[model samples]
Target: MKAAKAPQAPEPTGDPAERLRELKAGLARAAALGGHPPPSLIAVSKTVPAEAIRPLIGAGHRLFGENRVQEAEAKWPPLLAETPGLELHLVGQLQSNKAEAAVRRFDAIHSLDRASLVTALARAIDRTGRHPLLFVQLNLGREPQKGGVAPEGLEDLLKDARNAGLAIFGLMTVPPAAKEPAPYFALLRKLARRHGLAGLSMGMSSDWDIAASLGATHVRIGSALFGPRG
Candidate 1:
């Protein structure tokens, strides 16, 4: 049998708009190879200033992910007011204390990995009437230094979130660094299936093509779109 080929990574060059186009094209090709629809691209604007992000916004990209609530609070409001149909995703480790603010500011939250956060976010959702799409970040590698919930604890967390009426969107993970991400992506997909969730917010600038091929519903891209942080 012929070996399945890998999709070519997009050249990480050009302006933000061009880079986004290239990235989307690459994602589409990978999805085609895997017989899945193209995943949504979340231009990770963490640490990227609004000026640098405007071009992508102007180019019609709306979904953006931010790592810090404060940074996003400072940067996205004005841009969102200017650009209609914008959606902001909080893609970092969220504090239980910041649940209200995060609920108010972000349209989606991708780091729901604990019971405390689940409770806090559910309260915030009720208080603010904002129920952002929530994803359970799984620590597939079970690294202690990471912020995700270990695989063994995922079901309990999911139960807590559901009991609190928080809509569980899907699963997200950042595989151990310097390792091939395919296995990790496949694992996340399998877990999502088992739990009856659909979205998979795996993949970053480095391994998004692989993530897309494995049925990612959302792929987060950062440095590749905005260049290196200053």
Candidate 2:
């Protein structure tokens, strides 16, 4: 009897390609719906294989959002070295302890929700001389479990961040899973307008079009791009 053939891993197909196509379609739809399309597409590759992402890079998708610092540390350096345009953004709840590593590696950070974390990141910035763009997260959902500065507190945070020399690019937030996220996305946009800020990082795989209509400058999509994380 022939020896059993080694088990083969399934081949990946239309992943990043399909993802880009979907993203473009989404952008078009969003543009047709209301306001201008976002300028940045943050591919939220939380658990997806890095191999799949390179195809996206080849397809002209260079900005990626990693939620965890350790994973980014593991995946970003080589890809960035190989593809110079690659931009790695941090898009999850960040710990103060990780600020040092975060400031050094990420091109932008999307979770500046508290003074303590901001202080930590500022200190890290001073030590590393690396100041990644900052997005002050707002508690749009007002969810008890979520992490963001209460919307009422946004100005003070933005003011301090500006004074510290940290680039206050814009703001971000996660709407409660219970209702439509459009309101929250819109709220962020309105707040950005109020503060005269430039970027708005909202929306995800499911709600980006609404986010775009509401003036999101950056949309972080994961599942739609990677076909649901394993």
Candidate 3:
């Protein structure tokens, strides 16, 4: 019997458009390694000016992520108008007060981790008639600085979201920085399975191939896709 081959990491070149192709092809290969479907790639466009992102958009990449609602509000409207079918995601810590704004601007929110957020999102959805996909962020490392719910608190948060009529499509996490991320990704997959959730939003630029191999449904790639933030 032959040993299995490891997935090749994406070669992100300096040009954003070319890098997009490289990353997409790389992710497809990686997903195949684990027999999982290719995960959606969210170009982490936070802090990247519209002009720089336009090239990638022109290259047929539509999904993007922003770290702040206000920033996204400033730049995305015109870009969205110019390009139909563009989907935006909020990948930062969202203030409960900004729920309505986020719901109005984003197609998905990857930072739903608390009861207050669930309540706010529910109200926002009611007012805006928009149901942005939500993902529960888990603090697998229990890091105090991060924005994820502690592992022990995930169940209660999910219950709260359910009660508030918020739909959670997936789980998200940022493993402890500078540590081996495979275990954390694996654990997130287990937790999502235990709860009967289907989406797994794990991995970033450094370990996206590993995340895909572990069944991540979404991988947020910033620097790898857009080059380093300024």
Candidate 4:
């Protein structure tokens, strides 16, 4: 039997609000096909100006992701003050020194990868009394330039995170470019199960529907939602 197809992103539209709606509709459909609830759509606003992000917020999207602490700090604070219920996520590599700042600024962080980071985040949480949701990033592709814990080191890291009193909410990864992402997504799901984690923060603008169908709990989306960043 043929496998069910992943949902396709809706045709591009001039309106951001329309694009947001269509993208979400596609995600919902993909989840329905898999008999699972839709993944949380994290509109990756990295490098995107606040004005461009405002329309999506105006359209009622509350979840957003950013790649850098400074950039998010520069724009999101004002937006958060003006809009209640906005959740900001840090979706990029985090510096151990910036753990406190990241915990202070983001509602969730999708890149907890090393022992030092684990210690830093635990300390940050204790000091700040802000327990932002955490995801253990895995370098599934084993890329030299990537920021996730090597798969072999994941168990030890999780143990360290737990011992340090940090609660791990999920696993996150970025599949290698130009490669099929399904196997990576599926592997992530299995790893999450092995680790007793429920959240799977994988997929992006290019393949989130496939991620959704394969049981992603969160998808980081950027260019597809905001168009090519200038």
What TM-score would each prediction reach against the true structure? 0.95, 0.89, 0.95, 0.95
| Per-residue lDDT over 43-81 for candidate 3, one digit per residue giving the tens place of the 0 to 100 score | 999889999889999999999999999999999999999
| lDDT per residue (tens digit) for residues 1-230 in model 4 | 55445434445466888888988898999888988899999999998999999999999999999999999989988899999999999999999999999999999999999999999999999999999999999999899998999999999999999999999999999988767788999999999999899999988988888898999999999998898878
Candidate 2 residues 21-111, lDDT tens each?
7676766667567758544778888887779888888888888999999998887788888989788899998999999999998989999
List runs of model 2 lying over 4 Å from the truth: 1-14
Worst 10 residues of 4 by lDDT: 3-12
Count of steric clashes across candidates, in order: 0, 0, 0, 0
For every candidate in turn, the CA RMSD to the true structure comes to 3.7, 9.4, 4.4, 3.4
Model 3, C-alpha of 149: deviation from truth (Å): 0.5
**lDDT of model 2 at position 67:** 94
Model 3 is weakest, by summed lDDT over 10 consecutive residues, at 2-11
lDDT of each: 0.90, 0.81, 0.91, 0.91
